[model samples]
Target: MTEALLNVVGVSRSFSAGEDELTVLKEINLQINRGEMVAIIGASGSGKSTLMNILGCLDKPNKGHYFINGQDTSAMDENELAALRREYFGFIFQRYHLLGDLTALGNVEVPALYANEGPHERQKKATQLLTRLGLSDRLEHKPNQLSGGQQQRVSVARALINGGDVILADEPTGALDSTSGEEMMKLLRELHRDGHTIILVTHDPHIAEFADRVIEIKDGEIKDGEIIGDTRNDNVNAYQSSDRAATELVDNPPQTHPQTAKQQTTKYRINWSRYLEALKMALIGMSNNRLRTFLTMLGIIIGIASVVSVVALGAGSQQSIMANIASMGTNTIEIKPGTGRGDRRSGRIRTLMAADADALKTLSFVDSVTPTVRANVAIRYASETVTGSVQGVGTDYFRVRGYSLAQGQFFAEGNALGSVIFLGHLPVRVIGVTEPIESVSSNSDELNVWLPYTTVSGRIFRQNYVSDITVRVDENVESEVAEQGIISLLTMRHGTVDFFTINTDTIRKSIEKTSATMTMLISAIAFISLLVGGIGVMNIMLVSVTERTREIGIRIAVGARQTDIMRQFLIEAVLVCFCGGALGIGLAYFVGVIFSYSGSDFQMVYSGTSIIAAFACSTLIGVLFGYLPARNAARLNPIDALSRD
Candidate 1:
């Protein structure tokens, strides 16, 4: 009936002056109808580009109430404006605005790539458009390989790939020769003929003539504006039809305009097809700069690898230490007798004696008490004597340690002085065994002799049996409490805080502390790699901004919001690093395999949480380091960008 496509009333724009605000545009009014072409023409500094930017949704006016196809423009923020632009506008720029590294089809595919379209959709659309532009042969040819006219065609094709509602062309041929310029202008006319609504901004009067309507601005004011060749003789008839249809459409609406708040609004929804295209574009970009991408990713990869490797190593070391300590015995308490060195109240005083060991055995919680008298001793087995440390103890040593007899049976009580001795499997392997050794060396070749500790022909091996007492507490008693009770009992003999003591729980705590410190140290070293990678991403993204200056300008001119540009660069950076992180994860897995082969008793658990954390960190680095470069691109003046060589 009387549906409005775009409405702008009394819009004004200005900038700062020394002390007074300088007016750029004053009281500008304009409207654009669906399926129509309008050109805005003016000299430089006449605010024509500024007005075009507002109309293309690139910016908001300093003072204006504007509506586009019935949607209010005043209420949108930068991101919302970007979504609106992506949903509705396609931009073609002067200077061909083609990315130097991309082929013709790639140039056409950039926008859809930003939209993240699928590869199939991007390829089909890009190929179809390039073919239509007579660039089927040049699809694989890069921008430098094509003529200026052909490059502009690629740009035009890019604008058309997304099914956007409007095309915004800013001086579309300003950088082309006359013939090539004419060719590009003809392409625009062709696009218009194909039913696309276009708003071409140009200073050339001939270029403005290509549009169906032209608005001329001078000194920031519209000097002339009008539409031609659409005049109908019967205004009364047209107005009468509009008047009647307005009431009918408004009253008996098929759908309520102001439906309940819960209803879904009618904003255009961008298909997910473009996002896939963006991913493909990113892949191509990385391929074009393979070295840069690899270098960038190397930081993250090395960091993750170092983290995993160091953690594995540290974890293994901790386990080994704990196992060795626990292997000695579980819930075993150590009691050391000290010679009198200082204060008698101190445990260093010689208060513990063999009598103390006898007294400890009487305690209710004590399972078994083994008094160890260790020294290097020689074994005489028919002149093949081997020397090793001796552990002199009663039969109770076997009960507390539960050591397996790989060779011979443990010594029995009555076997004392019967030439009986138990050799550890390690020592047994060192010495050769000739006899069956049914008494001692049944498993190993070691030559050991065990004799009674009570009396061996009246010869004394040990004087005081309390050098160290290994107290095996009952498992029925909790280790910590039992240890405390043992400490209290021994403290009287070896006074308070006199002797160094440890238990199963104490060793376990030490192991945990060691593991924690190791994990943190490894992580710190790994983070250095990530930081280096972040610097790489930042550097590359900055380069990209500089390289794609004109492209960024074109996107902004076409209604791409600031955040859109930010997202493009940030995602590109992140994609590169994240890809590297993924590869690193694979590499770490291989390293884990290698570690397993090396006989390291550690489980290299590269859990999903770790992978996701690495990936997320990579992405975060991209956003953090790529932000400034992206912002630099976004803050660029669209006119200056279009004018860039």
Candidate 2:
């Protein structure tokens, strides 16, 4: 005779119950032939369903050998068993086992997708199956939207999608009414007549009578096995004569030829269609729970915003400071008396003089030169009496200091001050009022006055020596080189190194270094916040896995591989963080806009590199933090997952 399509020899199954092993099936011997309609009937808890699970390769037997078409399945791995289920066996459950998130058409196409079918092919096949199953109008309806009978019909269509060579129905009609039950049994009979091997597990005698052979199972043992019914021939004649609609329902035969084991084991190539389906499912999951998704993304949003904003704020502050420095004179040098600052007895030296300024002005590298002498004096102007510094300066002092006048012009060589101001009981005219210089002093209330050096030395203090000289270096000359030239000339004239020069360029370098350090420090703190956001993503993903346990089981039942399940959850997590990153960038820009409008002295300067880095960081967090949850989902036992609420 033909080799048995399914052969079970001495198969004994057991489950752990507390401290002891509870045996479910004992020495179960069964044989099922291709193209034969058989029923394994028993009462509840009789292990009939367990036997059917073994036959369908959904569960393994503790002891014995189960074979499919003369090939032993004892050495097959989890993935190999999944391939068997995908290519050969199809399951119909009492609860209908339809994915809640998928439409009827989508649910029917699931198995075909896992079988590596293309989108257009699977969609066309799914549409035809649903249309023939009387669900053409309900193709887009979700499981919750369909009635009990309609859902079971969709489940039947799903089972037949990937060539159901052997169909296992575990109480398929238990949840349906009498009329719907009769209709379902009729559909099964039609499939059986179309050369599909039908294995029905039920306690209802009426349902058992529809099959050609009935095996009575009791207490995990086959009690009576015989060909009790001659219903095949009679049903064939009756169906042909009376059930014209049922004949039209299953007019086209299912695809019975499946890929060989070698073909199934071929190295898996990247399937873009499968990945796209996973992406679509991920989007649907996120859309269904908008609040949870947004909350999960909030941490990433805050972290990315902090990092980008801090970088921008640092850059803006640095630019503002550098601009102020530039206004003080690009290449200016200051000459002070004595060896250096805070020197003792420098006032008694009296070596610096106006002749030095006149000599420096003759050099080609010196743009302008000014000699300065200062003394604290009491000044009276309009009813305000204040102590201020009265400075003796050359005609080019304003040009050397890069000062712009707010009102009135600088005094000429012999011109007197325009307005009289008292200096130590001597009255002197004011030449001009300089614009407010931020670099000069922090206190805006400080007072200053300027006069010609000759007037201060001869008329006011009656001293001939000058305190110091200020030099504006030519644009083509380096400040350091010019400083060296002046030191050489002055030390030769004085016969010793009695003065020191301060290069404004050196101060600019120091300030820039300090600003950069501050930016790096703040950015490091922001990176810590990003790390915390990654941890938050991991926690929420763990919760998601627990909530969708049943959904995971459904995919497994439809032949989804471990990697397929993992890809779904991982992609969902990445999408969450990616969207969060985009929102965070937007938030950072919004902060910049508000800061600019607040009338602050400096504006935020956002960097393109920082924004791109933030996006990469968020995507990496999604993968790093999302792995454990995805692995937990993929590693779940199919039976345990299905049984969970």
Candidate 3:
């Protein structure tokens, strides 16, 4: 004899309620034949729904063995049971537990996706099924947009998408009007005629009259394990009369053949099609709630923009400071009379003199030495009188200080003792005379006047002392070693080390280091904002998981593994963060450009590495913060999730 399609032996199920065990089903022994329409009927609070759930592999039986085609279901794991539901059983929920995020056509393709069906095949099959159910015009409508009867039809189409032989519907028409209910019953009858086994649970006795067999269940026990009420003798006769056709239909189900069957045998372990479908759904969900999505992304955008801009500004500041230092020559040292200390007595030193400058120039690595004498003198240029510094220097001042002559020439060697002087810190025409060095600054520009050392000591200051001296060392020599030599020489010449001070490349490096540290501090503060943004993302994702509990349940019902649901939410979060990060990068550059053009001293340098790092970090933040919410969603109990409002 052929084995029964579904067999239940002494099945019982219970729940713990207030320290008392309430049994829902007890010793339910039943057998459903292939291609038979069996209805399990009972009043309110009866165990008919529980029996249907167990039959559908949606819930486990506590004390029984359920066999599907002689294979015991009790030994199967959750994944295997999900496969059985995906490949062999189709459920039609009473409330039409459709995914609100998916349209009718997408909903119908769900089971096929889990079965690893190709997109074209699933689409074609879903289209045909939806059209056959008279929902072709409503294929793109979401659940909330559809009427009760239309939704019921969509659910029916979903149940048949995987070519399942067993249709376990729990109160399929319980929520519909009479006319819609009658239409639903007729569709089930047609499916039964087409060689599908229909196990329906209902409370309506009239509805049970149409089935080939009705098993009445009260409380947790079956009243009679046989056909009752309306016998449907004519329907039984028709089934018997068409037994040969039914057998043929069962052997070769609709829209399937030898090649398709052979292809089905090679089940794909990883269903990328489901992932693609999930991504599409996630995008749709985000788009539908545009305001919330944007609000959620705002934190990341601001944080990344702040960080990128700070880093860019810091880089620009370092470059600018180094450039300013390079203008004075990296191998140059400045020797001022005072020690670099915050004391007035230490600054009043007249130890550095013209002889010291000549002595320094005689060193092996020293290229040039220019002793400076500063006088606050007033110059009159064509009715303009300005008071500024008139500097006395040697002829090699330009080469030593990295300054350039935009127009006029420097003083000749013969003019060293001559009265001829190159004027700076004054207007181009002084007393109807044109002077050089007017292009570099808007205020008092320094004028270079070359004079013999003896002439400057006697003529300008009437003293033999110089305020400061600059030494240009050869590029091949170490400036630090030269600095030590200059200090030792000055100490010996002055007879006291506290009387003079010298610096070589140390001031520029100190400035660069200080600027860098400031920049890092700013960047660190920006990262704190990024951390705040990550926390915001976590909160928003948790709220999203809570809001979509029902939708999560529907996906699980359609054969979505926990990982699938987890991945879907994770993708949504990452997509939001990536988009925000991209926008932040754009904003950073835009603001940088504005600041650069706005004549601010703070310039921004956009680095390729910084942009890439910012975006990568933002994506990582999404993943790190989104995991908890995704895990919460994945670990949800499908039964409880479905019941959530």
Candidate 4:
């Protein structure tokens, strides 16, 4: 009278070949309650396997309603069905489905991953399960290293992890020798006695005798299904193979859409339980080419460091430059002439004149415009001729050119022209002036200088035109708007976009933006390296899968579900990328420091964002690129996999 753990009513599944429709299952009905074991017995072509597939929810019947724990399976989507399977069913098969990369304990811990238990709890549970399954000694051993019985035991332990009520076993004893097969049957009997609802599919009549019920499937339908013996609906304690504690081996199956399972994979093993395995694998991988790994990591380090350092140092340099410019005066706009020495009005005209500079002062937004004359003349102090460049400017030039006189005051307006000039440090030092040019000390020939424009207005240095017209706009106006206005005015005045251009505050921002763009480009390049690293991870994992094929086949054969295989490989890949990312982050910071110290204006910058970004990016690359190899490992046929060697 107890509620059936599983109920299949009028279920049918079929396939079409050319014009013929072949029914795999036809109008079948089956019901099983708690604490009972049953077998569907038939020959290879008799559709028992097809029925088993439908029973396991690995495949859907063409027509039928399969209810598990009273939930209508037909009403559920693939995702819901997968979730239900994970939560409510376990599986065992003829070939043990033990994961190759994972030790016995790790294999046992696979199903619990979907439950999201912490690593500590998962490991504890896995350990207990392996011990109860008599795999305690094989806990650290890979499936390849274990005997057939041992591998099956690990699969059994994995299946039992979630304590799922039903065990759907397909050919539970098909791949084993008689002794191993008998042992497996004994284990199944023990599980049945422990209150598990098991549906076993087999062809051997002797195997069917162990079940409380037997369904003889022929063609594509259940020809006869009858309860062969008294079925226990209460606790079947005697059937529980382990006694150390029920926690020894729990039961749970995979949760994944079969179709999507063929496409995307999102599976991972318990990290804490398999941390050592991952670490060991990492060590082995690293040892395989310590120098290559180190060098590859070094490239990432340098790349990250170069990028970070450049950002930091560039930011600092820009900050300093902006400060200097601001200090020089924000209202100022540069009007320096170009290198082309063409006539002021000729084709591709570049040579500027004082007249053009004077005309700019008349603009409505303009406040002050100073015509500036410049020449690298070797002026004599007294037998000492210094070839440093001399700047002959109007009174307003000091405010526009960011000239902070190192010492004495600058030139005055309308003052009488004398042999006076404000020199920069280079000019001051060049003249070998021991003291200030006037009342102040200039220890070296400081070159910074200032002079009235009229002084050089007709001299050999300049006659009519000045090289530049530094414009100081109204302080109240937003400098950017003023600069743009000035650019528009000048571009119109010049009548040619190529005849020198304006690069004011508006354009200055574009430079910083361009720097950011360059950073992105560099980042893209670095990501390529990470991808190469990901490929390394994938390649390594694929190799591992090949080496462990037999082990995988064993787990799948016994009871290790598809998801278990996927988790183990993905975890391995993620581990590799994470380790690489951590190292890369550290390297980037150091490179940033180096860039900061370099003399170049550009410096590297590091951010917590970048560090996390690097890690996340690597993880994504691992999953995106790693999943293919991982899935290939997971999807390998158990029959073909174990038969490899």
* Highest lDDT against the true fold, candidate: 2
Candidate 3 local lDDT, residue 252: 44
Query: What is the Å distance of residue 368 in model 3 from its true position?
Result: 9.8
Choose 2 or 3, whichever is better by lDDT.
2
Tens digit of per-residue lDDT, candidate 4, span 510-599? 555775677577656665655566666666667767877876665444344566567666765666566666776666666666656776
In model 1, where do residues sit more than 4 Å from their true spots? 1-11, 15-47, 64-72, 100-103, 109-126, 162-167, 192-199, 205-281, 323-331, 334-550, 556-567, 580-645
Runs of candidate 3 with Cα error greater than 4 angstroms are 220-235, 238-274, 325-331, 334-396, 399-501
Residue 414 local lDDT, model 2: 45
In order, the Cα lDDT scores of the candidates are: 0.66, 0.83, 0.77, 0.63
Q: Which ten residues in a row have the lowest lDDT in candidate 4?
A: 432-441
| Best prediction by TM-score | 2
lDDT of candidate 1 over 560-614, digit per residue (tens): 5576666666667778777777787777788888977887665565556666777
Ranking by lDDT: 2, 3, 1, 4
- Tell me the RMSD of model 4 versus the true structure: 11.0
Q: Write the per-residue lDDT of candidate 2 for residues 371-482, one digit (tens) a residue.
A: 9998888998767788998889999987877778887778773454376867877887776788967543223356778888998999888999998888888867877889
Off by over 4 Å in 4: 1-5, 16-20, 68-71, 112-129, 220-602, 605-645
Q: Each candidate's TM vs. the true structure?
A: 0.64, 0.79, 0.77, 0.54
lDDT of 3 by residue, 410-527 (tens): 6552222212222333223211112333222122255433434455566666787876788887767778888889998988888887544455477666787899889989999999
- Residue 454 lDDT, candidate 3, scale 0-100: 55
